[model samples]
Target: MWVFSWMSWRNSLKPPDSLVRKLNRLRRQERPPKREQGAKMGKRPRYHLQGTAFTGIWLLALGFLLFLSPPPDTGRCAPPPTPTAELVVRAKFPAGKPQPPPVTSTAAILVDAQSGDILFSHNATTRLPIASTTKIMTALVALEKLDLNKQVTVSARAVSTIGSKSGLEQGESLTVEQLLYALLVVSGNDAAIALAEAAAGSVEAFVAEMNKRAESLGLTDTHFANPSGVNNTKHFSSARDLAVLARTALQNPTFASIVSTRDFALPPLADGTKREFHNHNVLLGELAWVNGVKTGSTPYAKYCVVVSGSTEGVSLIAVVLGAAEDETRWKEARALLEYGLSLRPRTLLCDRGQLITQLDIGDPLGRQVNVVTDRALVARLSADQVATGTIFWEREARFPIRAGEVLGRLEFTCAGRSLGSARLLAAQSVETPNIDLLLEFWRRGWAPAFLTGRK
Candidate 1:
């Protein structure tokens, strides 16, 4: 039975002649045998040692080839994580203590000139005839557009002007600078007309320009029918608009000097006579800080005034229209100026070009770029209200950025309300390593070099 089993196993193990010949050829190719195999016992099967060795060698070679190849990855480079929003807290001013409103004329407003903030207003937007106070804007426009030393000849029509003696003879010549002083100081109607004609070739044309300028400056409720506030049906300005106009006019240093002066002497006339003029603004003499502006009165317009002054470091402007009396207008204007100066000044919230955040660009080299705000963030609040507000930053940044690129935005919020927002920009450029560079580093085994090059 054992002999029969051995015979069956040998028959099953036999290969075709072609395969047997190929195995014999492979065995012949070998240099020599490392060890001899034992002979098979009688009635027991003997395995071929060479054939087993050859099979094991082939299997080992196949395993080595498989090891050299990288494995197929079901998951490799992952997408970057999404950024989450964060909340920020800040301080703000407390509510100011309430106070009783002050009494004032028919129309009045006291403003902080530097901040353009109205501290007190009494029918400030009511339109009324501003009388000669309109000369402030006229003088301001001339000062801005005309060269101080440029000579101007008085026109025959300017000499024939009615009202307000300018002591000018026909054909009298003066520099633009001298005319501005005469126009503002004594409220010269002829000087105003002459300046208008010189600036725009005619008073009517100049009035058109004045109205155009007023519209451009956001004076929606103002109309100028004449260069001087001569009580025309079409000429009217509100106390609020006049305050804005006066504040704008005072921004020009030349206009400021002209208005502030107590007295000015005009250039020589054709008859070799000179005219000296005193300022019409009465507050300049009483208040140490009061500089110059204008005052006007007519039976139809009542009394009006635009007073500008600076006490300590705070500058104030007050405009009053349709006052019951001239002294009352001055008194109201003074009270408003005092109240404005009493309030503490507001500080600008941020400096220009401040760096707000840092953005990460997924460079293989691990480089980070900084993001900054394009313009400064600024807020004006009363001193008491400065402690309660909050500021927050929001960014929508991405990877692989260039310098000067816009990344996102920085927003300012106070008490859950958004006050303002500014754009965020990339402060530096970030570059990613190319495949060749990465492979070279991997080959060299310098792992730290790829990770440590950020600025």
Candidate 2:
């Protein structure tokens, strides 16, 4: 029985005769013929080693890349860190002194239109694009060079120019005054081009004239590259310069009237229909204090406005440039004008008995006299101006001064302009020197040093 079991295990291990014959036949068919020496090289051990090494290298590289890669996100992301607020101190002026109002404009200025005194400024000299505000200069140049009633035929070029049109047709005829109304009240680019052509025969010539006029007006930080106030690299003006231009433009009655008008209708077109235009300045009817000026806006210039306001005899011009929105420009301009008006006019610059200076009269007796202002000098001045005014004493008092006697003139100037002046008077009488004292003064070659002041 043990022998029979061993025989059965051997039979299971051995292959069948028919299967062995088929395996031998397949091996014979796949075998390659042997090559002669130097005829062609047989399969090399080096090739097999190189292929194995390449496979290993590729597997190692793939493993290295997997190790370096970041892990996949499996959960929700956390929110960003919250920012903390910081307290920033901008200015530390005196508590009582008026500070400039917070505004959104990149540049702004407030000026006394009557005296041309700058009441407030923020980046006033920085050059910035000024959109339709360019029409101020255009109107100024036109009023100076063209007649109001003269009719001008609209050119195809003017009508073809894009932006802010007044519905002007090519070959249409309109008077200079009508075009000016359209240009100022409506801020029409077509009217601007037409007026430019009418004034100088071409827009290029008119732009040159505009720059020439800007130079003549001493607008050092301003330049005009076009009449329509299109946004251009070469077209720019400063807040301070725009204030000056608006002040000058307000002086022209016609320009002033056109800018102040809320609504105007052009004469009927050839089809017997009228075209009505309204002022772009929303502050006109909304705020009683706001008067004539212009509004401007473009992609580069943002929202800009030059506003003129008069209240209780205080006339002011406020300029806001590069405001983020139309409402921002109007709000900031009104705030500036109101701020100027708040500074009371007719401020007492100098008190009646204020002692300006003391002087020695060359009396030989070593006598000093008090030079006091006889009357008060008052004028419209901002608080800052009153605090920093300069006095110019024109004449010095002579010897033998009497009480209440007008010795000489003393002028009070602020910001390069004279506010008011008063006569310097002796607070008390000073008797003339005796003959011997006069002789001693003459012998000592003593003279009054009042011009430079003794003390």
For this target, which candidate reaches the highest TM-score against the unseen true structure? 2
CA displacement after TM-score superposition, residue 338 of candidate 2 (Å): 0.9
Residue 214 of model 1 has an lDDT of: 93
Q: Give the runs in model 1 whose Cα sits over 4 Å from its true position.
A: 1-101, 268-274, 345-455
User: In terms of TM-score, how similar is model 2 to the real structure?
Assistant: 0.56
| TM-score against native, each model | 0.55, 0.56
Mind giving the per-residue lDDT tens digits that candidate 1 earns over 159-218? 777656567666768888878887888888878888998888889888888988899889
User: Residue 99 error for model 2, in Å?
Assistant: 3.3
Provide the overall lDDT of each model, using Cα atoms, as 2-decimal numbers.
Answer: 0.69, 0.76
Residue 112 lDDT, candidate 1, scale 0-100? 74
Which regions of candidate 2 fall more than 4 Å away from where they truly are? 1-96, 345-455
Error of 1 at 288 (Å): 1.3
List the lowest-lDDT window of 10 residues for candidate 2: 83-92
Clashes of each: 9, 0
> Considering only N, C-alpha and C atoms within 3 Å, which residue pairs clash in candidate 1?
92-386, 92-387, 92-388, 92-389, 93-385, 93-386, 93-387, 94-384, 94-385
